[model samples]
Target: MTLDPEDSKLITLARAARARNEAAEGAAVRDETGRTYSATNIALESLTLSAVQVAAAMAVSSGARSLEAAALVTAGEGPSAADTAVTGELGAGALHVAGPDGVLRS
Candidate 1:
């Protein structure tokens, strides 16, 4: 698929997060203000969070009121229901899914 430059940037950011952390999943979100946030999945003994959730939280904590788009880079099929719910609450318009190879899947 031909993605907008901004969307492509999100995928690049997500891929970098995954590579840097050696994590199973990474996610990036673009807020309404055009700010982007990226994060890797958190999987500690006492806490677990999907990459998408972490990215969304980062956007929110950084004072983003709404989301314009989100991207996930994972070997898995797609983002979880919880991930969608969080982004939906933040008014995300699109959720882009990409493989570990950085190829857009959906």
Candidate 2:
């Protein structure tokens, strides 16, 4: 499938970010004021490109189609780690993009 210019740009940016991280030898974070940073920050930025790709593909192919059907057949089936990631707790029921109430408590 052909990629839109914006999507292409995002992918290029993602690749560049990956390359930069690799070049830094995975030094994705540094201590500045007795704080811990994470490579995940960069990784998440890079991940946005891929997510956009998925969204674009869905919009085009799923035209006039039911999202539920798409979810069942086209969308990758899996449990979302959102809950675990947000709650800092594992083995939770009903994987979701947000916590049980759709708000990530800080």
Global lDDT of each candidate = 0.96, 0.24
For model 2, residues 1-106, the per-residue Cα lDDT tens digits are 4433432333343334334545221111111121211121123544632222232233334441211110100022322243123212311121122112212111
Off by over 4 Å in 1: none
List TM-score per model, in order: 0.98, 0.26
Task: Go through the candidates in order and give the clash count of each.
Answer: 0, 0
- For candidate 2, the per-residue lDDT at 66 reads 17
Judge candidate 2 against the unseen true structure and give its global Cα lDDT, from 0 to 1. 0.24
lDDT measured at residue 44 in model 1 versus the true structure, 0 to 100:
97
Best of the candidates, TM-score: 1
Q: Which stretches of model 2 miss by more than 4 angstroms?
A: 23-106
lDDT of 1 by residue, 26-71 (tens): 9999999999999999999999999999999999999999999999
Say what the RMSD of model 2 is: 18.2
**Candidate 1 — number of clashing residue pairs?**
0
